[model samples]
Target chain A: MIVAKDVSLTYQDGTQALKDVNLRIKAGEIIYITGPSGSGKTSLLKLILGMEYPTEGHLRVMGQSMVKDEEDNIRKLRRKIGPVFQEFKLIRGRTAFENIVLGMRFLDFTPKEIIENSYMALERVGLKHKRDSLVDKLSWGESQRVAIARAIARKPSLILADEPTGNLDLDNALNIMDILTSLRDENTTVIITTHATHLIEDKEEGTFIRIQEGRLKMERRGVEAYE
Target chain B: MNKRAYNLAYFLKESKTLFKIDFLSNIFSIISIGLILFILSLVLLGWRVSSYVIQIVEREGEINVYYDLSLQEKDINYLMEDIEKIEGVSSTSLVSQDEAYNRMAEILGKEAGILELFDENPFTPFIEVKIHIEEVDSILDELESMLGIDYIRDNKNIIDRLQNILIILKVLGVLALVAIGVSTLIVVSHIIRQGIYNNRDQINTLELLGAPDIFIGFPFILEGVFLTLLGGVIAFILLKLVLGLGYSKFFTALPFLPLPAEESLLIPIGIFILLLSGLLGIIGSLFGLAKDNEKA
Candidate 1:
């Protein structure tokens, strides 16, 4: 769970990246965030990830103050949240399987368990065939799939994806969406950012929030409903 | 793998991984260090041997004194006592002219017949005085001022020239050490900095992961220690080889050569060199890693 109350971040040049933001994301709820470029979308994700602190007001993630100086607590919090960046952020020299297993290396997972769970996650993303392939050798869709496998491999409590399907075709986007939506069955919360309207139109796992000019504009829902 | 096996495997794997990255650079660093240290150690040992040899030669070629032929036994005895009282003389003995002629004859062996052509012994009734080597020049001058003595023969000029050569050698030794020390330090620092540059990304990742400072620095320190220790071992072997080669020429039968004594000092000296080399490595690494705080 993440809560931001009147959180504001200002750069040295007096530019406000995030201003007067108040939001709370509950456990096990998938939320889609749609926003334009420079709309504070990545800033919000960074705040929740504890990568940056708000200049003013309180920001809390998983019951710990985001501004606390305890580095151990921050690492522990990060271990619980798996994030997929727009660039994939995979270590280029490593194989796809190695990239997928990287998230679990710091979590005290046994090597055998990492291999097994990594394979299972790769199977879910239809990347099991490319497990041994180098990340640089993979196609864009395959690389995105590898990134998805890496995020889901460790069974983190919260999964954050920034433009998960931005560079993928429709079929690949649908495939990625299916893999992300499957997290709901495991009660894993998901937050995603995208401005690709066609990808999520009339297809929903939970709620949708839209933002423009660094501020949230509306919260809406599609035909899909929670039972 | 089982837990214990897995841990061992992981350690081996990581060590091998790091070794691949560091092995070639570390080897070149070690070899350069070893060659430099070996040459330095050889020079020091050579200088030490040469100094000891020079001291022995100077000791053998001591002052030989001559008195007037007319001086009697009583005069010779009085002169011996006077020479003994000289401040720098360690010991003195009176040699009658006849006795000196006889000794010279024995030295010349069959040529004594030619020396017998003289009606009388031409050798002087001298009091031969051996002075401490350090005070030879001053003592020679003092001996020359004696009123009744005809002449004093001391190899002070040769001794002074040898001493000058030794002084120059000592200066050269200091210069060599300083040059080698400076060059080795620069070479080691460059290698460590290259290592840091190569692993910069991994270091940043470790920092982001909240790794402790020691954990990040431990590997570099170990690298420095390993290279230095290897260099020291090579230098010790080289020193031993050099000593072995010249063992007979310099210290063959000299009782004061201290063969066993020197053997005892070898290990301690080798360890000291290794430790100093390791410290140099760390110094290089510290400078190399200083930039990380700013970049990270």
Candidate 2:
């Protein structure tokens, strides 16, 4: 669902976050981007989310060009992609149910569908018992799950999770990974970035990407391919 | 583009939460707006009353025309016909010396004993000419040129002063209206901006979730509208009470002034203020949203 050709990103402070990154991602594929801290893993997700534009090359997400002038189109594209921000970005003074359903309110879901899907997403993340709890009262792991529920509840075509496993114990982080991978189906593509490389070191399927010093290498497992 | 319909209850609930965030400040804003609008309503009431008084006075405009005592009854009849034919004159009728004396006694009320000191009636018979207020000067010129007319006495000074008062009241009313409009706009807009500032985090989250700008800003718009509408209702109540008391007092102490019926005046002005409040609420919210978006 994403195509990047010789993409490069430079910040206003002259920091080159990414250099000549080239990659192709198909629908329904589970991809994991593993790198150390400050290795441009989050920067790649930012480009995919249209939070930043490519400075030197072309990039397209879900058939919409990621460019400054295509703001409206990029906004529409965002509605089709569920993003789990590194910070979670859960709104305070709201219940977990409210936060989840708010993501689908402006989408094509009816009121009934919004409630049902919100509850279902909460159930999937194992937070149904805490659905009524305010996000501010929730623990760090609980907040992260609520953020993930908010993303998957919309049934987006693509899911991009930026550092979803940060500040979590091994069990909680693995549980988050399981929930994210389970969301991938015949029509959904899931791409997750994590600095904790051990989480996906034993994976048998899906695409594995490694980035170091602003350059990236790709390896595929199921297709027996390396790029 | 698949458009989704939002729940009205959801919007209202959101607005309620936003309002309660700073409940005391919002209550103060309502009181301030209501008091401002109340002042405007009082100005409008004064304008309406003074205009009505001017209208009644203009309609009753009359001048006294004195003629030579040597004229016979036929000559007086001819003079009356000629005065009625003038362009500005509405009608003419001769008042006898006895009738004038009786009018003066009625006006003097408890002081009519002053007229009994004279042996003969000192009042002279005259033709009372009713003319249009706007045509007073022309009519006076015509009356001065009439052959049998000895002198003409018109209340031009009183009429001119009344007209000047009407003009001043009109200008003051317009200035008060403009002041009310500008102050209300500024207050509502500032309140909306404050609401937006307080909810900036929620707004940013909504934006990242792909919510449309309209969806993100709808609750804030509702908040602004609700505050202004409350202000309007409070102003309406105060205006009604003041009008009731003012009308009763005027009827008791200044019965000569012509005032419109209470229901007719209050209903229209009440409706107008409420509608204006609603309109300003929407415009002010839009202005706040536009400024916030610019900053973003």
Weakest ten-residue segment in model 1 chain B by summed lDDT: B253-262
Candidate 1 CAPRI level = incorrect
lDDT of 2: 0.87
**Which candidate number maximizes DockQ?**
2
Looking at model 2, residue B12 earns an lDDT score of 90
What RMSD does each model have against the real structure? 7.5, 3.6
Show pairs that collide, candidate 2.
Answer: none
Single out the weakest 10-residue window by summed lDDT for candidate 1 chain A.
Answer: A218-227
Q: What are the per-model numbers of colliding residue pairs? A: 0, 0
lDDT (Cα, tens digit) per residue for candidate 2, span B119-227:
9999999999999888998888888888898888887886678778878888988998789878887888888888899999888778777788899888888988898
Q: What is the alpha-carbon lDDT for the whole of candidate 1? A: 0.73
